[model samples]
Target: MSIGNTFYQHKDIHKKTWRHPDGRVSNEIDYVCIAKRWRSSLLDVKVHRGADVGSDHHLLIAKFRLRLKRLPPTPQRARPFDVMKLKQPTVATQFQLELRNRFQAPADCEEAEDQWTQFRTTLTKSAEAVVGR
Candidate 1:
């Protein structure tokens, strides 16, 4: 078991992390592990013997210098109306009337994609007028 850092250079007091109740047996059981690919990012690792956490194990701290890649923000699209609102009698009637008046049936020569876009725009506009944006 390699502890991932140069543990040999550290003093005996800092090296032995856990102390037995009888104070006879002490060993370095705790460790900080990182992939070899990220070994360059790991700067230093040490055990703080002065910390009194009422535990047998000492506090181990590791310093790292890392650069995280930023991800591109996703494009926000227009949200659809709430389907539950259509269950209400007044809202249902209003929605039907607005959709019927605003949506003109696309011609035979018109593309399916263009017709779908027009339908979506008309529905969203009508829903915004009644159910709000």
Candidate 2:
């Protein structure tokens, strides 16, 4: 643990945490301690004398900033097909024939999303068979 006030600069009045009963002397006795690893997150530390808790010691305050990390997005599909194989005449013809045969089936899906999903699956399967991933 480490003291937070030592890291920041403040005036004498803002740094003092306690006052003598005679009302003529004050001292910095209270402290805001935190873990050494999280010291960078500690922004500032100060004394709040306005808070009336009926105690000789003033209220101590410590400010901090914490940052959370975001997670990476998940992949939606498998590996992609190597379309470069289609550059050859024989591979392009084979891929075209496969796609034609697969698409020949009637898509009786009522929703547009189902129709698109079926078309995408058929195209991907055909490409996988004709090309290399």
Candidate 3:
């Protein structure tokens, strides 16, 4: 309360920020203090006594004159569907059929990594067909 122009000098109604439980004592214990550098940005600060919050303390509001710069829109990418739904009997049957129709199992002599890649691709395509993107 001893700062520069930020001091509270308004009427008693506007100055009181808190009240005692006995409904007899009130005090200006709450505040919205701003740094000296950005003091000009603080347009107004006051207590809203009419806003009911079921508390003894009144709501303190501060208004600023700042304008936030808008950021460019971000590009959205398509996300994969959840494959866990395959646990359902109907969904599992459809997914299995789709995979069986498209799957070309790697040859017996193929590398393990190649077989894994093919399996993953087949599973992904089956899920996409059964559950959508």
Candidate 4:
């Protein structure tokens, strides 16, 4: 996403000072009122005026980091148990059996083994989602 104008320019990241339309001057930025809560963390803010190719409004970039309180870690696993049963005994062992059963060439069996390895990685990552224990 950062490929096209994905970055923001921060002239004053910490705080943006702009005159409000009202008689009383106030800060101005694109965000809504709630941004007041986040303004304090602003490290840099910049205004970029000029057509960014086709976009009408000038682009603005802001950079800031949140000061979050300490948080606990979350843990997850690859799978529970059932998916294991679906897979053949040992991938190598089953490779031999299936190859023999189908009269498949060794090269073909090797290809199948490679496929199963990919499946194993994807399946493991999908099933494991552990949090605080």
Candidate 5:
């Protein structure tokens, strides 16, 4: 929405030649009249610069409220090529234990490397087991 710098007490006439990097806005119509017309939908309004594109106009920013209804997400049907899980399963107590006791970093470089090597081996095996390839 465009507004005369009067109410805002900020004016920059030189910005008339300025242009926004994003194409979200460009020189447009009056902002005030539009805002008052749809005061409920409009959340906020802002003014922007309009560089001379052979048109003498300033850009405007208008915010609007959008209503969306929440719906429960449904599980999508799996495709043959999809690499996700073949079956949806619940997390078990054993899985939680493995995750909690997985690994710890040591102060020494050699100890850390040993732990990291074991971790990588376990990960590779897990991936291979999942796909059964």
Candidate 6:
């Protein structure tokens, strides 16, 4: 553990977190402590005099910045379609006819990803209908 008071520089009034009842004496009695390993994450520590806590000690504020770890993405598994059905003459002819009737070129210029997605959808639907999945 480490004391956060010494980590930051501030005015005397801001540093004084506590005061004596006589009003003639004051001191930094309050403290903000943190782990030594995360010392660099502690941005600033100071006293907030504006807070009306109704106590001899003032409010101590500590600022910190933390970065969360990112998770690794899981790989997606692709399902295999029944391509063996295409060996039959009737299935092959029906698959070819379905592709010819459903396939259409884009009306305007489009992104490569969009075109690939459209083509993949058409092929998958046609294969499921004419062949099997």
- The candidate scoring highest on TM-score is 6
1-133 in candidate 5: lDDT tens per residue? 4343223323444223233457444333443544444445556555555434453455555556866669999998744322344343432333334444654444454676776887776644544444333
Highest lDDT scorer:
2
After TM-score superposition, what is the CA distance of residue 45 in candidate 4 from its true location, in Å? 1.5
Task: Output the TM-score of candidate 3.
Answer: 0.43
lDDT digits (tens) for residues 1-133 of candidate 3? 2232236467888878899999899998887767776776777777899998999999987777875679999999869687678779998888888888998858873688989988888888778889877
Error of 2 at 49 (Å): 0.7
Q: Return model 1's CA RMSD, one decimal.
A: 5.6
- Tens digit per residue, CA lDDT, model 4, 15-132: 3334344636434344422255665566655545542545333355556788977968777653344545335456545444543454423454358777676556544443332110
Query: For each candidate, what TM-score against the reference?
Result: 0.50, 0.54, 0.43, 0.27, 0.26, 0.55
Models ranked on lDDT: 2, 6, 1, 3, 5, 4
* Stretches of model 6 off by over 4 angstroms after superposition: 76-133
Q: Write the per-residue lDDT of candidate 1 for residues 1-133, one digit (tens) a residue.
A: 2355454477777667788989999988888878777777777777887898999888887888997779999999868668788899998999889888888877752788988988878888888887764
TM-score for candidate 4, residues paired by index: 0.27
In model 5, the runs with Cα more than 4 Å from the true position are: 1-29, 32-38, 50-52, 69-133
Instruction: Tell me the whole-model lDDT of each prediction, alpha carbons only.
Output: 0.79, 0.88, 0.78, 0.45, 0.47, 0.87
Write down the lDDT that model 5 would get: 0.47
CA deviation > 4 Å runs, candidate 4: 1-34, 72-133
Q: Is candidate 2 or candidate 6 better by TM-score?
A: 6
Candidate 2 Cα deviation (angstroms), residue 57: 0.5
